[model samples]
Target: MPTITTADGTEIYYQDHGQGRPVVLSHGWPLCSDAWEHELKVLADHGYRAIAHDRRGHGRSTRTSAGHDMDTYAADLATLVEALDLTDLAVVGHSTGGGEVVRYAARHGAGRVTKVVTAGAVPPVMLQSPANPEGTPIEAFDGIRAGVLADRSQFYQDLAVPFFGANREGSTVSQGQRDDFWRQGMLAGLQAAYDCVKVFSETDFTEDLKALDVPILIAHGDDDQIVPIAAAAYRAIDLVRLGTLRVYPGAPHGIVGAYQEAFLADVLEFLAD
Candidate 1:
């Protein structure tokens, strides 16, 4: 497996495929680059170079007990991009990855970034505070942390039902799909997964979102149960200067896979414009 050494000396695994305009994908929390496998293949076939990396404690990357916060996450990505010497890149991030991309563009500067997209991203802050009354309560996140620590396997299994919107009355969820999600969740280290909860839930990206100068596309599902669109996706759209918002009605948080064709079309259109 190909890997890049971060500033903190952590070896992160990644996949680089195809050839054309470069697009780097970042996956959400508790999942690996495999989450973007479908998008990568589609983008690569459509004349784009696709690259994705497993975060420090997820997938095939080193399972460290520390450095699972947003700052470290963005830094690791910056290191990877610099190592590849990529320019005019379009960075697409989903869920937690969405927050990472926003922070990366703001912190590292957008000299090499051409465009950015955040799908079902948790940004502009997610945790509720006195100032941000609409954000998710910290208690909710505490429950998530406790659940994962108590019974990781069972908690992950239960998470799939809502994460993919399989709990919806007319939705269809396959055993294989659920198993694949579970398998990926189980592959990650416990400490990393636990710590990441705080990172994605509490890290404030308000300034980061406000600072991005490149074109940004915020695509989120209206029916997202994981990270509500109002507190996250919509908030990001309002903050970014050149951000465009697209809300998928009745779509779940996993809109990337659920509405693959439409999502790809929109992304291509944005990237083309």
Candidate 2:
């Protein structure tokens, strides 16, 4: 397991495979680099250098009780990319990872990156405010915080129900899927996971999205119950100067696995363009 030591001395675990144009993957909330297993193999086999990392306090990375915010997340990724001496690469982020990459591009500049892909990501903003009146209510995020504080394990188990689109009509969630979700969630530090809920939901990425000069591919499921396309992906596309939005019909938030083939094809297509 290769790891990079950030400026803060946190050992960030990551996977780098194959060669060619680098394609770094940033996994969703509470999940680790393991969540990108399918994408990693596919991208590598397709002659692309696929990279995925466990955010600090998640998976094999160092577990800490502090620095679990958007800025820290973006800085951790910047450190990894620089340490690896990667440039002109494609960054693909899902859910919270979307927030991380968006902030990374805005804060760190687009010199190291060529393009960005956001799938079922949280951007522009997830919480409602006077400026963004249509965002998800603050109380909804508060309820999530309350749930995690109450019982972390049970809370993760429950969150998996909707995270994978299992709760949708005609949708089926396998035992393995639920187990995988729980397994990854359990691997993360409880405090980091809790803190991320606020980071993803409250942080404003409007300016970040607007600042991006590279082409952005926003692929999101219209049926996503976790992060609705309206408040997240749709709005994100409008803000970016060069952005293409693709709505996955009847797709869920966990489209990485839920719509794996389509997701990969779209990503590859975007990168090739």
Candidate 3:
């Protein structure tokens, strides 16, 4: 397994495959690069290099007790990109990883990044501070933190319904899909998952979005139950000058997988432009 050592000496594991224009994927919270397995095959078949990393404390990466915040997460990705010496790379981030991509692009500039796509990303801020009156309440995140700390296995199992919009009246959720999600969530370290609640829910990406000049594609499910589309997706689209928002009607937060064909098609078209 290929790995890169962060400046702090943390060994982060990653997967680099295919040979063409590089397309890096950053996964959502409580999940790892395995979340991109479906998308990776699509990208590879279309003649693009597909790479994904198990975020620190998730999947096969080190289960560190500290540095679980967004800053460190962004830095870890930057280190991977530098180690690979990649350019003209298209970064696709989902949920918490979406926050990492925006922050990394802003912090490092557009010289190395060709384009970016954020799906169900929590950004422009998620916590409802005085400055961000429309953000989600801290109590909501607190609930998540407490759940993970108490009984992570059950917590993750319960999370699947809402995360995938299975609770909705017309929603269809297979037992296999739910099982896969639970398996991935359980694979991650409990400490990292707990700490990351703050990283994804509290970090402010306002400055990052304001500074981004590269072409960006913002896709979100209008009916997302995990991270409300109105607060996260809509706000992000408004912040970026060159950002294009593609709303998937009645789709859940896991729209990339739930609506794989359409989502992949849009991404391929966007990359072609």
Q: After superposition, which runs of candidate 1 have C-alpha atoms over 4 Å from their true positions? A: 256-258
The lDDT, on a scale of 0 to 1, for candidate 2 is 0.90
Our model 1 lands, by Cα RMSD against the true structure, at 1.1
Clashes of each: 0, 0, 0
**Against the true structure, what is every candidate's RMSD?**
1.1, 1.1, 1.2
Residues 1-273 of candidate 3 have per-residue lDDT tens digits of: 889999888889888878899999999989988889988888999999999999999999888887998888988999999999889999999999899999988897468998999998998788887777878898999999999999999998899888888888877777678777899999899989998998999888988998998999998888888888878988888889899999888889885445666788899999999
In order, the Cα lDDT scores of the candidates are 0.88, 0.90, 0.88
TM-scores for the candidates: 0.97, 0.97, 0.97
- lDDT rank, highest first? 2, 1, 3
Q: Residue 68, candidate 1: how far off, in angstroms?
A: 1.5
- lDDT comparing candidate 1 with the true structure: 0.88
Model 2 lDDT-worst window of ten? 252-261
Worst 10 residues of 1 by lDDT: 253-262
lDDT preference between candidates 1 and 2, better one: 2
Cα error, candidate 3, residue 19 (Å): 1.1
For 1-273, candidate 1 gives per-residue lDDT tens digits of: 899998777999998889999999999879998888888898898899999999999999999997988989999999999999999999999999999988998888468998999888999888999988888999999999998899999999999889888988878667677777888898789999999999999999998988888999999889899989888876777788898998888778775455666778999999889
